[model samples]
Target: MKEMQTFLKKYHEEMNWEISNESYEKTRASLLNNYMLLTTEVAEVAEELRKAFNFTHSHILNGMKDSEAFDLAKENAKEDLGKEFADCLAYMIKFANYFEIDLEESFYKKMDEVKNRKNRDVSLSRK
Candidate 1:
Protein backbone atom coordinates (compact mmCIF):
# COMPACT_ATOMS: atom_id res chain seq x y z
CA MET A 1 0.00 0.00 0.00
CA LYS A 2 2.89 2.36 0.73
CA GLU A 3 4.23 1.57 -2.72
CA MET A 4 0.84 2.44 -4.22
CA GLN A 5 0.75 5.66 -2.18
CA THR A 6 4.23 6.62 -3.33
CA PHE A 7 3.37 5.81 -6.93
CA LEU A 8 0.10 7.78 -6.76
CA LYS A 9 1.84 10.74 -5.09
CA LYS A 10 4.42 10.81 -7.87
CA TYR A 11 1.71 10.52 -10.52
CA HIS A 12 -0.27 13.34 -8.91
CA GLU A 13 2.84 15.52 -8.83
CA GLU A 14 3.47 14.89 -12.48
CA MET A 15 -0.15 15.70 -13.31
CA ASN A 16 -0.02 18.90 -11.25
CA TRP A 17 3.07 20.02 -13.10
CA GLU A 18 1.51 19.33 -16.45
CA ILE A 19 -1.91 20.82 -15.81
CA SER A 20 -1.91 23.55 -13.21
CA ASN A 21 -0.30 26.67 -11.80
CA GLU A 22 -1.98 26.16 -8.42
CA SER A 23 -0.69 24.16 -5.45
CA TYR A 24 -2.16 20.76 -4.58
CA GLU A 25 -3.84 22.14 -1.49
CA LYS A 26 -5.41 24.71 -3.74
CA THR A 27 -6.65 21.79 -5.82
CA ARG A 28 -8.66 20.41 -2.90
CA ALA A 29 -11.51 22.77 -3.66
CA SER A 30 -11.75 21.02 -7.00
CA LEU A 31 -12.60 17.70 -5.34
CA LEU A 32 -16.11 17.98 -6.70
CA ASN A 33 -14.50 17.81 -10.11
CA ASN A 34 -12.62 14.71 -9.02
CA TYR A 35 -15.87 13.21 -7.84
CA MET A 36 -17.29 13.81 -11.30
CA LEU A 37 -14.28 12.11 -12.82
CA LEU A 38 -14.76 9.21 -10.44
CA THR A 39 -18.38 8.97 -11.54
CA THR A 40 -17.32 8.60 -15.16
CA GLU A 41 -14.72 6.02 -14.16
CA VAL A 42 -17.41 4.07 -12.32
CA ALA A 43 -19.41 4.01 -15.50
CA GLU A 44 -16.43 2.56 -17.27
CA VAL A 45 -16.31 -0.07 -14.56
CA ALA A 46 -19.93 -0.89 -15.28
CA GLU A 47 -19.05 -1.36 -18.92
CA GLU A 48 -16.26 -3.65 -17.86
CA LEU A 49 -18.73 -5.51 -15.72
CA ARG A 50 -20.83 -6.19 -18.78
CA LYS A 51 -17.79 -7.56 -20.52
CA ALA A 52 -16.78 -9.62 -17.50
CA PHE A 53 -20.15 -11.28 -17.38
CA ASN A 54 -20.09 -11.82 -21.14
CA PHE A 55 -23.51 -10.29 -21.31
CA THR A 56 -23.61 -7.80 -24.12
CA HIS A 57 -27.08 -7.07 -25.51
CA SER A 58 -26.19 -8.84 -28.75
CA HIS A 59 -24.86 -11.82 -26.81
CA ILE A 60 -28.09 -12.01 -24.89
CA LEU A 61 -30.29 -11.54 -27.92
CA ASN A 62 -28.36 -14.00 -30.08
CA GLY A 63 -27.36 -17.19 -28.35
CA MET A 64 -23.78 -18.45 -28.03
CA LYS A 65 -22.82 -21.99 -29.11
CA ASP A 66 -19.06 -21.69 -28.85
CA SER A 67 -17.36 -22.39 -25.50
CA GLU A 68 -13.86 -21.53 -26.80
CA ALA A 69 -14.94 -18.08 -27.89
CA PHE A 70 -16.45 -17.43 -24.46
CA ASP A 71 -13.20 -18.59 -22.80
CA LEU A 72 -11.31 -15.95 -24.78
CA ALA A 73 -13.92 -13.34 -23.98
CA LYS A 74 -13.61 -14.16 -20.31
CA GLU A 75 -9.84 -13.64 -20.40
CA ASN A 76 -10.20 -10.29 -22.12
CA ALA A 77 -12.88 -9.31 -19.65
CA LYS A 78 -10.59 -10.09 -16.74
CA GLU A 79 -7.89 -7.84 -18.18
CA ASP A 80 -10.37 -5.02 -18.78
CA LEU A 81 -11.70 -5.35 -15.24
CA GLY A 82 -8.19 -5.05 -13.85
CA LYS A 83 -7.56 -1.88 -15.84
CA GLU A 84 -10.86 -0.32 -14.79
CA PHE A 85 -10.24 -1.18 -11.15
CA ALA A 86 -6.79 0.41 -11.32
CA ASP A 87 -8.33 3.55 -12.76
CA CYS A 88 -10.74 3.65 -9.82
CA LEU A 89 -7.84 3.18 -7.40
CA ALA A 90 -5.92 6.05 -9.01
CA TYR A 91 -8.80 8.44 -8.40
CA MET A 92 -9.28 7.17 -4.85
CA ILE A 93 -5.61 7.86 -4.12
CA LYS A 94 -6.02 11.33 -5.56
CA PHE A 95 -9.01 11.87 -3.27
CA ALA A 96 -6.92 10.84 -0.28
CA ASN A 97 -3.97 12.99 -1.35
CA TYR A 98 -6.15 16.03 -1.78
CA PHE A 99 -6.86 16.00 1.96
CA GLU A 100 -3.31 14.89 2.83
CA ILE A 101 -4.77 11.70 4.22
CA ASP A 102 -2.58 8.64 4.71
CA LEU A 103 -4.53 5.87 2.96
CA GLU A 104 -2.30 3.07 4.23
CA GLU A 105 -2.77 4.03 7.85
CA SER A 106 -6.46 4.67 7.40
CA PHE A 107 -6.94 1.28 5.74
CA TYR A 108 -5.30 -0.49 8.67
CA LYS A 109 -7.34 1.50 11.16
CA LYS A 110 -10.61 0.77 9.39
CA MET A 111 -9.79 -2.91 9.04
CA ASP A 112 -9.05 -3.11 12.75
CA GLU A 113 -12.43 -1.57 13.49
CA VAL A 114 -14.11 -4.07 11.18
CA LYS A 115 -12.25 -6.93 12.82
CA ASN A 116 -13.27 -5.81 16.29
CA ARG A 117 -16.88 -5.55 15.20
CA LYS A 118 -16.72 -9.06 13.80
CA ASN A 119 -15.21 -10.37 17.03
CA ARG A 120 -17.88 -8.68 19.09
CA ASP A 121 -20.57 -10.18 16.90
CA VAL A 122 -19.03 -13.63 17.31
CA SER A 123 -18.86 -13.30 21.07
CA LEU A 124 -22.47 -12.19 21.28
CA SER A 125 -23.57 -15.05 19.04
CA ARG A 126 -21.76 -17.56 21.30
CA LYS A 127 -23.55 -16.19 24.35
Candidate 2:
Protein backbone atom coordinates (compact mmCIF):
# COMPACT_ATOMS: atom_id res chain seq x y z
CA MET A 1 0.00 0.00 0.00
CA LYS A 2 2.85 2.35 0.80
CA GLU A 3 4.56 1.54 -2.48
CA MET A 4 1.32 2.06 -4.38
CA GLN A 5 0.80 5.40 -2.66
CA THR A 6 4.32 6.52 -3.49
CA PHE A 7 3.96 5.47 -7.13
CA LEU A 8 0.69 7.32 -7.48
CA LYS A 9 2.17 10.39 -5.88
CA LYS A 10 4.91 10.42 -8.46
CA TYR A 11 2.49 9.65 -11.28
CA HIS A 12 0.18 12.47 -10.28
CA GLU A 13 3.07 14.85 -10.08
CA GLU A 14 4.29 13.80 -13.49
CA MET A 15 0.82 14.34 -14.94
CA ASN A 16 0.49 17.69 -13.18
CA TRP A 17 -2.64 16.41 -11.50
CA GLU A 18 -1.54 16.94 -7.92
CA ILE A 19 -4.03 18.75 -5.68
CA SER A 20 -3.33 22.46 -5.86
CA ASN A 21 -1.56 24.21 -2.97
CA GLU A 22 -1.37 27.52 -4.74
CA SER A 23 -3.84 29.26 -2.43
CA TYR A 24 -6.53 28.38 0.08
CA GLU A 25 -9.41 28.78 -2.35
CA LYS A 26 -7.62 26.88 -5.11
CA THR A 27 -6.82 24.02 -2.75
CA ARG A 28 -10.41 23.85 -1.54
CA ALA A 29 -11.76 23.80 -5.09
CA SER A 30 -9.28 21.13 -6.12
CA LEU A 31 -10.15 18.97 -3.16
CA LEU A 32 -13.89 19.31 -3.87
CA ASN A 33 -13.38 18.47 -7.55
CA ASN A 34 -11.35 15.39 -6.64
CA TYR A 35 -14.00 14.33 -4.16
CA MET A 36 -16.68 14.60 -6.84
CA LEU A 37 -14.57 12.50 -9.21
CA LEU A 38 -14.01 9.88 -6.54
CA THR A 39 -17.75 9.63 -5.98
CA THR A 40 -18.30 9.18 -9.72
CA GLU A 41 -15.81 6.34 -9.78
CA VAL A 42 -17.64 4.74 -6.84
CA ALA A 43 -20.87 4.97 -8.85
CA GLU A 44 -19.17 3.29 -11.79
CA VAL A 45 -18.23 0.42 -9.49
CA ALA A 46 -21.91 0.10 -8.57
CA GLU A 47 -22.81 0.08 -12.28
CA GLU A 48 -20.48 -2.88 -12.81
CA LEU A 49 -22.18 -4.76 -9.98
CA ARG A 50 -25.59 -3.95 -11.51
CA LYS A 51 -24.45 -5.25 -14.87
CA ALA A 52 -23.19 -8.47 -13.30
CA PHE A 53 -26.46 -8.99 -11.44
CA ASN A 54 -28.49 -8.38 -14.59
CA PHE A 55 -26.37 -10.89 -16.46
CA THR A 56 -26.90 -13.45 -13.74
CA HIS A 57 -30.66 -12.89 -13.83
CA SER A 58 -30.72 -13.23 -17.59
CA HIS A 59 -28.84 -16.51 -17.38
CA ILE A 60 -31.21 -17.80 -14.72
CA LEU A 61 -34.18 -16.92 -16.94
CA ASN A 62 -32.65 -19.14 -19.61
CA GLY A 63 -32.78 -22.09 -17.17
CA MET A 64 -29.28 -22.02 -15.75
CA LYS A 65 -28.93 -22.82 -12.04
CA ASP A 66 -28.67 -19.66 -9.98
CA SER A 67 -25.24 -20.46 -8.63
CA GLU A 68 -23.84 -21.40 -12.03
CA ALA A 69 -25.39 -18.35 -13.64
CA PHE A 70 -23.90 -16.12 -11.00
CA ASP A 71 -20.49 -17.75 -11.39
CA LEU A 72 -20.49 -17.03 -15.09
CA ALA A 73 -21.66 -13.47 -14.55
CA LYS A 74 -18.99 -12.90 -11.93
CA GLU A 75 -16.31 -14.17 -14.29
CA ASN A 76 -17.55 -11.87 -17.04
CA ALA A 77 -17.60 -8.89 -14.74
CA LYS A 78 -14.26 -9.57 -13.04
CA GLU A 79 -12.01 -7.59 -15.34
CA ASP A 80 -14.22 -4.52 -15.49
CA LEU A 81 -14.87 -4.70 -11.79
CA GLY A 82 -11.16 -4.81 -11.08
CA LYS A 83 -10.62 -1.75 -13.26
CA GLU A 84 -13.32 0.16 -11.42
CA PHE A 85 -11.78 -0.80 -8.09
CA ALA A 86 -8.39 0.34 -9.27
CA ASP A 87 -9.85 3.72 -10.25
CA CYS A 88 -11.33 4.14 -6.79
CA LEU A 89 -8.03 3.13 -5.17
CA ALA A 90 -6.08 5.63 -7.25
CA TYR A 91 -8.21 8.52 -6.04
CA MET A 92 -8.02 7.30 -2.45
CA ILE A 93 -4.26 6.98 -2.72
CA LYS A 94 -4.03 10.47 -4.15
CA PHE A 95 -5.78 11.92 -1.15
CA ALA A 96 -3.72 9.85 1.26
CA ASN A 97 -0.52 10.92 -0.44
CA TYR A 98 -1.50 14.56 -0.35
CA PHE A 99 -1.88 14.30 3.39
CA GLU A 100 1.29 12.18 3.82
CA ILE A 101 -0.78 9.49 5.45
CA ASP A 102 0.59 5.99 5.92
CA LEU A 103 -2.37 4.07 4.58
CA GLU A 104 -1.05 0.60 5.41
CA GLU A 105 -0.41 1.56 9.03
CA SER A 106 -3.71 3.37 9.30
CA PHE A 107 -5.59 0.39 7.86
CA TYR A 108 -4.15 -2.01 10.41
CA LYS A 109 -4.73 0.45 13.24
CA LYS A 110 -8.33 0.94 12.20
CA MET A 111 -8.93 -2.80 11.91
CA ASP A 112 -7.50 -3.34 15.37
CA GLU A 113 -9.65 -0.58 16.79
CA VAL A 114 -12.74 -2.12 15.24
CA LYS A 115 -11.84 -5.53 16.57
CA ASN A 116 -11.46 -4.18 20.12
CA ARG A 117 -14.57 -2.00 20.11
CA LYS A 118 -17.01 -2.88 22.90
CA ASN A 119 -20.17 -1.78 21.09
CA ARG A 120 -19.55 -3.73 17.90
CA ASP A 121 -22.68 -4.86 16.11
CA VAL A 122 -23.68 -8.47 16.67
CA SER A 123 -23.96 -10.71 13.62
CA LEU A 124 -27.57 -11.49 12.67
CA SER A 125 -26.74 -14.46 10.45
CA ARG A 126 -23.99 -16.94 9.86
CA LYS A 127 -23.04 -18.37 6.50
Candidate 3:
Protein backbone atom coordinates (compact mmCIF):
# COMPACT_ATOMS: atom_id res chain seq x y z
CA MET A 1 0.00 0.00 0.00
CA LYS A 2 1.19 3.46 -0.92
CA GLU A 3 1.64 6.06 1.77
CA MET A 4 -0.50 9.24 1.71
CA GLN A 5 2.29 11.57 0.64
CA THR A 6 3.44 9.21 -2.10
CA PHE A 7 -0.11 8.64 -3.36
CA LEU A 8 -0.91 12.36 -3.39
CA LYS A 9 2.33 13.10 -5.22
CA LYS A 10 1.48 10.46 -7.81
CA TYR A 11 -2.08 11.76 -8.11
CA HIS A 12 -0.88 15.31 -8.63
CA GLU A 13 1.55 14.15 -11.28
CA GLU A 14 -1.04 12.04 -13.06
CA MET A 15 -3.80 14.67 -12.96
CA ASN A 16 -1.50 17.56 -13.87
CA TRP A 17 -2.63 19.51 -10.82
CA GLU A 18 -0.29 22.19 -9.52
CA ILE A 19 0.20 22.00 -5.78
CA SER A 20 1.42 25.61 -5.82
CA ASN A 21 -1.85 27.37 -6.63
CA GLU A 22 -4.10 25.97 -3.93
CA SER A 23 -6.17 29.14 -3.62
CA TYR A 24 -9.21 30.08 -1.51
CA GLU A 25 -11.86 28.83 -3.93
CA LYS A 26 -10.03 25.56 -4.27
CA THR A 27 -9.76 25.23 -0.50
CA ARG A 28 -13.42 26.11 -0.03
CA ALA A 29 -14.51 23.64 -2.63
CA SER A 30 -12.33 20.98 -1.05
CA LEU A 31 -13.81 21.77 2.33
CA LEU A 32 -17.32 21.35 0.97
CA ASN A 33 -16.40 18.14 -0.77
CA ASN A 34 -14.73 16.78 2.36
CA TYR A 35 -17.81 17.66 4.40
CA MET A 36 -19.94 15.63 2.03
CA LEU A 37 -17.44 12.81 2.19
CA LEU A 38 -17.39 12.83 5.97
CA THR A 39 -21.19 12.84 6.09
CA THR A 40 -21.26 9.66 4.03
CA GLU A 41 -18.56 8.11 6.17
CA VAL A 42 -20.43 8.94 9.34
CA ALA A 43 -23.59 7.38 7.93
CA GLU A 44 -21.70 4.21 7.20
CA VAL A 45 -20.32 4.22 10.72
CA ALA A 46 -23.86 4.56 11.99
CA GLU A 47 -24.89 1.52 10.00
CA GLU A 48 -22.05 -0.42 11.52
CA LEU A 49 -23.30 0.81 14.86
CA ARG A 50 -26.86 -0.41 14.28
CA LYS A 51 -26.42 -4.15 13.83
CA ALA A 52 -23.44 -4.09 16.15
CA PHE A 53 -23.48 -5.28 19.77
CA ASN A 54 -25.85 -3.53 22.23
CA PHE A 55 -28.19 -2.73 19.36
CA THR A 56 -31.78 -3.63 18.50
CA HIS A 57 -31.26 -4.90 14.94
CA SER A 58 -28.69 -7.45 16.09
CA HIS A 59 -29.50 -11.10 15.28
CA ILE A 60 -31.97 -10.05 12.57
CA LEU A 61 -29.56 -11.36 9.97
CA ASN A 62 -26.66 -13.69 10.25
CA GLY A 63 -23.52 -11.90 9.23
CA MET A 64 -22.15 -14.85 7.20
CA LYS A 65 -25.20 -15.19 4.93
CA ASP A 66 -26.20 -11.54 4.64
CA SER A 67 -27.49 -11.81 1.09
CA GLU A 68 -30.23 -14.19 2.17
CA ALA A 69 -31.82 -11.33 4.08
CA PHE A 70 -32.43 -9.58 0.78
CA ASP A 71 -34.05 -12.74 -0.51
CA LEU A 72 -36.11 -12.86 2.65
CA ALA A 73 -37.11 -9.25 2.13
CA LYS A 74 -38.50 -10.15 -1.28
CA GLU A 75 -41.14 -12.22 0.52
CA ASN A 76 -42.60 -9.18 2.36
CA ALA A 77 -39.95 -9.22 5.04
CA LYS A 78 -37.63 -6.26 5.46
CA GLU A 79 -34.57 -5.59 7.54
CA ASP A 80 -32.10 -2.76 7.25
CA LEU A 81 -29.20 -5.22 7.38
CA GLY A 82 -28.19 -5.01 3.75
CA LYS A 83 -28.05 -1.22 3.76
CA GLU A 84 -25.87 -1.25 6.87
CA PHE A 85 -23.28 -3.62 5.47
CA ALA A 86 -23.49 -1.97 2.06
CA ASP A 87 -22.96 1.45 3.57
CA CYS A 88 -20.05 0.23 5.68
CA LEU A 89 -18.45 -1.50 2.71
CA ALA A 90 -19.04 1.56 0.53
CA TYR A 91 -17.35 3.83 3.04
CA MET A 92 -14.43 1.44 3.37
CA ILE A 93 -14.00 1.34 -0.40
CA LYS A 94 -14.25 5.08 -0.77
CA PHE A 95 -11.90 5.66 2.17
CA ALA A 96 -9.32 3.47 0.48
CA ASN A 97 -9.92 5.12 -2.88
CA TYR A 98 -9.60 8.62 -1.42
CA PHE A 99 -6.20 7.71 -0.08
CA GLU A 100 -5.27 5.73 -3.24
CA ILE A 101 -4.77 2.63 -1.14
CA ASP A 102 -5.53 0.06 -3.85
CA LEU A 103 -7.44 -1.95 -1.23
CA GLU A 104 -8.40 -4.80 -3.58
CA GLU A 105 -4.80 -5.48 -4.44
CA SER A 106 -3.76 -5.10 -0.84
CA PHE A 107 -6.48 -7.47 0.34
CA TYR A 108 -5.55 -10.14 -2.20
CA LYS A 109 -1.87 -9.85 -1.47
CA LYS A 110 -2.02 -9.52 2.30
CA MET A 111 -5.19 -11.27 3.47
CA ASP A 112 -7.32 -13.16 0.95
CA GLU A 113 -4.60 -15.66 0.00
CA VAL A 114 -3.42 -16.61 3.47
CA LYS A 115 -3.99 -17.06 7.22
CA ASN A 116 -7.76 -17.55 7.13
CA ARG A 117 -8.86 -19.82 4.32
CA LYS A 118 -11.68 -21.39 6.32
CA ASN A 119 -13.29 -21.49 9.74
CA ARG A 120 -13.65 -24.79 11.52
CA ASP A 121 -17.08 -26.20 10.83
CA VAL A 122 -18.04 -27.15 14.40
CA SER A 123 -21.01 -29.26 13.29
CA LEU A 124 -18.92 -31.32 10.89
CA SER A 125 -16.07 -31.53 13.39
CA ARG A 126 -18.32 -33.40 15.78
CA LYS A 127 -18.99 -36.05 13.14
The stretch of ten residues in a row with the least summed lDDT in candidate 3 is 50-59
C-alpha RMSD of each candidate structure in angstroms:
5.7, 0.9, 10.1
lDDT of 3 by residue, 21-54 (tens): 3787885675465557657867765655443432
Off by over 4 Å in 3: 1-79, 112-127
Write model 2 residue lDDT over 1-127, tens digit each, in one string. Answer: 9889989999999999999999999999999999999999999999999999999999999999999999999999999999999999999999998888999999999999999999999998999
Model 1, 5-94: lDDT tens per residue? 778889888776222327766555477677788788899989977765555444544766456556656676887778888888888887
Task: Show the colliding residue pairs in model 1.
Answer: none
> lDDT of candidate 2 vs native?
0.95
Show model 2 residue runs off by greater than 4 Å: none
Give TM per candidate.
0.66, 0.96, 0.33
